[model samples]
Target: MSSEQLAIRIEGLSKHFSVYHSPLERLKHVVFPGRTKGFNDFRALNNVSLSVKRGETCAIVGQNGSGKSTLLQILCGTLRATEGTIEVNGRIAALLELGAGFNADFTGRENVYMNGAVLGLTRAQIDERFADIEAFAEIGDFMDQPVKTYSSGMYVRLAFSVAIHVDPQILIVDEALAVGDSRFQAKCLNRIKAMKAEGVTILFVSHDVGAVRTLCERALWLDKGNVRMLGDAFSVTAQYNQFLFEADNEAVPTSAPKQIEESIPQENSAEPPDAQQAMKLHRPINHWGSHVGSIIEAGIFNQQGERSSVYTAGEPLTVRIRFEPPDHADRNTMSVAFSMKDLRGTDLIVSTTWDQNPTGFAAGNGPLVAEFRLPNHLNAGDYLLAVALEDRSGVLPQYYEYIEGAHYFSSLTEKKQYGTFLAQVSQSVHA
Candidate 1:
């Protein structure tokens, strides 16, 4: 692609740090030169390459030691890469470590001008935007106080306010927004959405998968000094989540489940319906777990026990999940769960069989079916379903079969609903 079409481009980027055992060993190494070897080289990033278009928003996800911060620091020009070339086409504004560029001795107001100057804003520009920054920060009297007296949330509020109001062409955030309260975080997200709409290139680092899927178009998953996966936000985050789940359980399945045919079976027949027929797996469907058991079929049905994908508000609904049971699997340790999520992938409701049947159910020779019945309290919107079969025998639950986007449904109502769900209310007002 042409240089003008891209906001950020990197090639063969790498960073290495030298580790010294002690001060004496470092001195010996410095004094002896070729005679002494006292340090080991640690690579934080290895030959990483990426390209982001001018108006695209991308997210970076990884564990603590997975080089996520190192990559961001390099992009923000706070750290140097040992090898490779980087091209950043536009002016960059970064929110890295909390209180990174702030002077503790200076009041919030002074810090604002200083930060603005550092970002290449002249005194006139800073004066023109100071009022908006102050109002957005919402620090009130604290704005006149030294930063030393400010809370963590206050620091993030001021930093984020200045970073956004400066009219940056490129924005880089490194999880600093997580320190803010829920309301402030929501406000920040809405502002970010506005920025995205205005074609500001954004690179966000966050552990919240839901946020990544909701805000970003693409995501990069980093592992120990390497790129594990890079693709659309939803698919990349789904794979990352599965890796975490399996790693926590420390169990690798011997084999994967057999793929089912695409034909749908009769509801009254003994055979289970095909998963593909219940919902359109338009995008990739993620299924991962031990091969001991698997979800053969899943569907959402109405009160008449007929398959349906659309429901009226307050109507009765049933979710049926059919799966094979592992041989000699412990009944007490096995459980089934299903969750409802909005189209954006935010979880709205979750129900588990183990919550009701703590003692567990009996083992059967044939395929077992679990049905979850509940009233449709969801507002008028499209939704997705996720189901899982887990074995809780160990310290961490081991998933036997976890299927994401197993089914899709929609709810409709004549009355306008306010939020995600409709809550039952009984009220009387006195004049």
Candidate 2:
């Protein structure tokens, strides 16, 4: 990418703070500065470097106190780095700390104008997009109420609404969606999707691994004020999750055979079962556990029970999954389940053996098949199927094998529908 196409560039970035043991030490340092050793240097960021291309979505993830927040604050110009050379190419709008820029005494509507101005929008521009912001926030008459009286969700709603409406070339989000309800979160995600399509550069930070994997193309894993890994979102997030599961001080292997240049998505395919399959383009971001029992094969079947990667909406669909059991496996403790989610990571349907079919399985002598049937009520779109095998005999449930993006299928509709769900309707006019 050309330099003009770079949204952000940084080299040797670091931040340090001087910490004093007590008030006496602070006073001594001021009175007899040269004679006293009163402060210790605490490094929040240490020699970090990264780049993000224009219109790309990148994610920063790490444990608490790992400088993820500090990095975003520096990018948004809220905090200054102690040592670094930074370059930015466009206007930036950020929702960093909660109520960071809002005036608690002012109403939500008043803060909208103020925040928009801070983001480099004129009064006229704010006025033009005021309605859109309000609608997107959906806080109702709360817009007229003082921000101090608003709840956490209301605060985030107004904050995110203003940030997105300012039309900045770069947007920075720092775990703001965690405050909103599920529906509001989905709305915000959809809005983020729209912004990305318009070539808006995004820098997101969140503990929600699934959200990070779904929204970001590239990921940067920060460990103790240092770069742990930098590569494709799925790859980095998968390795980070493994590290968390281990919870050991030793670092997990993060090296990949090939790095994805500029974090572009990879094409994926699944072989057809019998008949010729349609052009199936998308690939599942598969991450599995190191359990003894593993998913050997997973397939999508049509009404005629033929393997397919595509199906029509309102038609019969089934997901047939087969698993290989480990040696001396206790089948009585096993449970199988699956869930379907749309492209945006919205959970559409979740089915489990305990809820649907609670049956004990045979021994580990042979392969086991778990089939799920659906009425095909999903709207026309791309979807992913995730399957899990759990052991529920103990006090705490254990995931024997959990595979996501295990299979993918597209639903075709005879008539265009609006949302991700399909519902039957009947109407009659009275004369």
Candidate 3:
């Protein structure tokens, strides 16, 4: 790619740190000057490479301690890479860890000027944009107070406002947006959208799957200080989510005895459903609980009473869940529930058996079967299902088993619909 089109470039990037047992070991290493240094070398980033084009919005996503912060610090020059090369063609502003660049004793106004100067702005330049920054921050009189007195949200607001007003060509945001309230988060997203439209490149790091898919065109998935996947945001996030599900399932302790099994079978009113096809399209299945019970099978059936993974818009649908409860389970107050999420990872609908009987439910003494009539009129799209069983007998409910991505299905349509819902329309001409 042409140099002008490249906003950031990294090659063979890596960061390493010395892991010492204690301060004594570190001091001993300094005195002895041995090859081992009385510590182990920990590689936080390993041979990572990626590129971002000017004006493109990109994201870095992963579980905690996956080298995400290290990579960003290297990009922002807050930490030096132990190996490799990095290139930046324009001015960069970053909102990293909380209270990273501000002095606690300095007033917000003073910090603003100091941060602006650090970002390559002169006193006159800061003065010209100071009013706009203050207005955007919306902290009012807090600007005159010491930053130490500011709440976490207030600090984020002022820092974000100052960073944006400095006319940075590249902006890096690390999960600091979580500190802001919903309204402020919305405002920040809108401002970031406007900045993207104005040809500013953005590097965002967030755990919010919806935000990552909506705002970024591309994503980089990091794992154990290595690049696991890098591609379109939707595909990357999908893979990342599946990875999380599998990881969680694996994290369940195997010491518990297997006391539950699938007792009921899915109905066979017609030809057998394609299990492999359904598995391929559906999100990964994850379960967790005390192992008192388990869901054996989950199926989606059309109005014809035939199991299927595809449906038509506005068609009647049913979700059949068969679960096996061990003898230790509480039968009188147990409940089953399910939730549906769209492709964007947004929960569109959720329902529980307790909705019909608020007090509780008694499943009697046989295998449990839950059949829920799902609402029609969902917009044409793919959706994933999550199911769980819980006991509501006491003040604190206990989950027996909660399985995520239990089923996946799609609603097809001939007519174009906007958003995730197809609303019935009726109108009359007044003129």
Candidate 2 residue 50 Cα shift, in angstroms, is 2.5
Scored by TM-score, the top model is 1
In candidate 1, how many Å is residue 355 off? 5.7
- For candidate 2, lDDT tens digit of each residue in 1-431? 67898999989999997799888988998898777787898999999999999999999999988899999989878899999988999999998878788999999999998888887788999999999999999999999999999999999999999899898899999997899999999998898989999999999999998788678988898998999888777657756765665564234332222222211123233321110121143343544344623566665678787866678877888877777654555677778778887654445798777665455586548777788887788888777776777666766445556655666778889998797788888989999
How does candidate 1 fare on TM-score? 0.82
Give the alpha-carbon lDDT of every model. 0.83, 0.77, 0.80
**Model 1 weakest 10-residue run by lDDT:** 263-272
Q: Please provide, for model 3 over 365-393, each residue's C-alpha lDDT reduced to its tens digit, 9 standing for 90 to 100.
A: 65668899965668887777767777777
Looking at model 1, how many pairs of residues clash? 0
Model 1 agreement with the true structure over 1-431: per-residue lDDT tens digits: 99999999989999998788889888988888766677888999998888999989999999889998899899888899999999999988888888688999999999999999999999999999999999999999999999999999999999999999999999998999999999999999999899999999999999999889889988888899898888777667877888897777575534544654232222232222222433453322466677623677776789898877799998999988887776666777888989887755667989889888865568667678899999999999878788888886776667887776777788999888698888788999999
Give the C-alpha miss distance for residue 369 in model 1, angstroms: 1.8
Among residues 3 or more apart in sequence or in different chains, the pairs in candidate 1 whose N, CA or C atoms overlap within 3 Å are: none
TM-score of each: 0.82, 0.71, 0.74
